[model samples]
Target: MKRLWGILCIMVCCTGELSAQKAAGFKGWFINNVKIANSMRTLDLSEQPAQLQLTFPRYQAHSYLVNMGIAVILNNNTTLNYISDLNVEYHRNTLTDAEQNNFSAGYGFKWRFANAGAADYFMAGDLQYLYNELNATNSLGGTFLLTLFRDGKRLNWNTNNFRLNNRLLFNLAPFAGFQMQEILKSRQNGMAGFILRPEFSINTSLAFCKKAGPPYDKLLAIFCNYTGRDDAINTTSFKEHYTQLLHTGINYYLAYSPFEVSIGASFNDGSDPLNGRTQQQYWQVSVNFLK
Candidate 1:
């Protein structure tokens, strides 16, 4: 009996130590934002369009994206955060055996200022870069048969098809949100349960350079809040080179002690009609390491 009790105590101690380590240093989520069909509503698995019956060669575009974030506690009331995104995209044409590939990357930093409370406040800034290359042959019985359209531009040649959008966009955002913990308790394990968190932020983007035409460059709107317009010249709400927007999100999680599996939805109230995205939203399934 004594030996059994000693072993049980050791196991408990080990478990407690592991839990503490997870809580102290780890804070992030593995979020897949572009796994399925591109839609604003649900998390659908199929790549097919709303009309699922007919699949065409021109509609063969796939994007894979991952978003990650880590937070470090600086003090009792301050935390610093780093976030990143990686994306790979491919488009294929069966008729002409043409292909277009794209890669995108984003990095951001955030500062959270809050007391020990259920709700927290933060400010964040981010940047994004994109690159695209197209590969096609000019052989169609001495006549080029391959044609591609991108960003309102038409393409007919195999060369000069690569584009590098190293625009270096910057977004500054301020956010406020709350997390409701212990919404549901587990029956068997005391440390397992459910949690709900909803957050919103206002944001503005600045691009030092200009695009070739209309539809300004914008990225990482989901991390921003209620910044005003970017039109006027000399006002607090006036952003010089870009636009202002609002971003909001809600997350529902199933917690198992230091880990959580969650489903989240986010939206951006975009106002730039020329930028192509008047409004944008998405749903994501994620595994949160710590929060």
Candidate 2:
């Protein structure tokens, strides 16, 4: 009787293990990737006699990024992932122009819950730090995002996940938070202006070749930003304005791998009195690794 009971217990344990594996599916892993890229641009927006476009001739910039993260499949119904990256960028223009350098660090977390049928709800958060040489300043900022969607379902003529996703890809995210600095140093006193910056972006990504082995993703996006100082400096008057930044791009991914590449261009029109009516254009290429 004792031996019979032991055999039954073993059978029960084996069954439980099989059930757990079936429920979890193929998920949960950690991966890391490194990225490097070069960019060129021209920015001209200043106020002078005859409205001179103070051309800051084409300059080369290099970036190095290190990303590391882990994702976990909590159950058949939920998933969680986290990532952190460190970025360093350097740029050089004319010899007379001062070289600029920026260092940033970012962290993000995402949580997803699967609903009945083809639908899911997700929440995410991101934080970043910026260090620059132009003003020898440091800035810290963060954003929070929330989303609800039903995959490939049309709710209205122009309302649905498809339209929303496309809008996000080429424009500002629907929900977001932002904060930053205004002035690094005061002209007379060594005072600084701590500013609050808020922004919104919307973009859309349209995928083609669904019937083919892989799909192609393209995006168009637009962003608007505003910033104001917390306290006005005595020597200099503080002003606030808005800027419109536009971008269009294409991205491609290889089969069965986290390797993907993208190419894009950005255009910016200044909306600030200090920046005058400046217009700037830039080109970019990037690689993403996930595993």
Candidate 3:
């Protein structure tokens, strides 16, 4: 199970970041990839809109997670968006005197279809690449045995040494949702007058990796035998495994003109679309600084 856990770590990475060059040439509106159901607002005019998240994962001593995005308006009813997702992490295992570093970056675009009343729809996709390595030593400063998967290309069996694996992955997601604006309005004199926006959406994502072969096929077989179920795996030998993710959530937006905040809970049910074994659901709070 320890070895399985290590393999799982390489498969479950997610997040994005913008390069300094990209930031300098950025133009358009900032919007969350999954939260675009209303008409474009003046807030979308901001040059750069970014999202930051901090997470605490076991054995990871330090980590940074950032998701930054920008959108360009193509017309009254259509918009184009570019987003970057990055995650950088460091892990330390005191029990084995081992350490590892992992990094991944993904950039993608989304097209917002025409909006009709309170309902909205969009089609978006992104490609992500990850590279990581591991090193370990024993009490006598001797090498410890470790094996790692290198982007499905080859396996590395070594000690006190690390190898690189740059895994290439892609995901296509479509979002459909509705928003009821002004569900609540506060009439406070001389104040920005609080307003509430309640929204709901169904999100689905299809993710796949480029490399297809052994272990990949064998891994899918293991999941099948373990789950004792069919249909979830989705692909066979030649195609390896393509994961499907289903995410549903309801969020309430509190806005005071120019500034908005949201709090919501979501239920995310799916396999680790990257062929990893990890799944989670939770609630979150977000403040839109540029809105």
How many pairs collide in each candidate, listed in order? Answer: 7, 22, 6
* Candidate 3 local lDDT, 174-272, one digit each (tens): 122211111111132221211121112221211122244322211110000001111222221212233333434433444423344444334434432
Off by over 4 Å in 1: 1-59, 71-242, 271-291
Candidate 1 local distance difference test against the native: 0.28
Which segments of model 2 are wrong by more than 4 Å?
1-100, 111-123, 155-173, 180-191, 214-238, 250-258, 262-279, 283-291
For each candidate in the order shown, give its overall lDDT on alpha carbons.
Answer: 0.28, 0.33, 0.26
True-structure lDDT of candidate 2? 0.33
Tell me the deviation in Å of residue 129 in model 1. Answer: 9.9
**Per-prediction TM-score, please?**
0.26, 0.45, 0.29
Candidate 1's error at 254, in angstroms?
Answer: 2.0
Clashing pairs in 3: 15-85, 15-86, 16-85, 16-86, 17-86, 258-291
Lowest lDDT block of 10, candidate 2: 40-49
lDDT by residue (1-291, candidate 1, tens digit) is: 243234335433543443464554333311222222221110111111111111334344432332222212212233233222222222211222322222222333334444334334433333323223231111100000111112222331111221346333333333333222221222233322222223233333333323543333322112223533332222222223444444444434344243333344445454321111233334333333322
Ranked candidates, highest TM-score first: 2, 3, 1
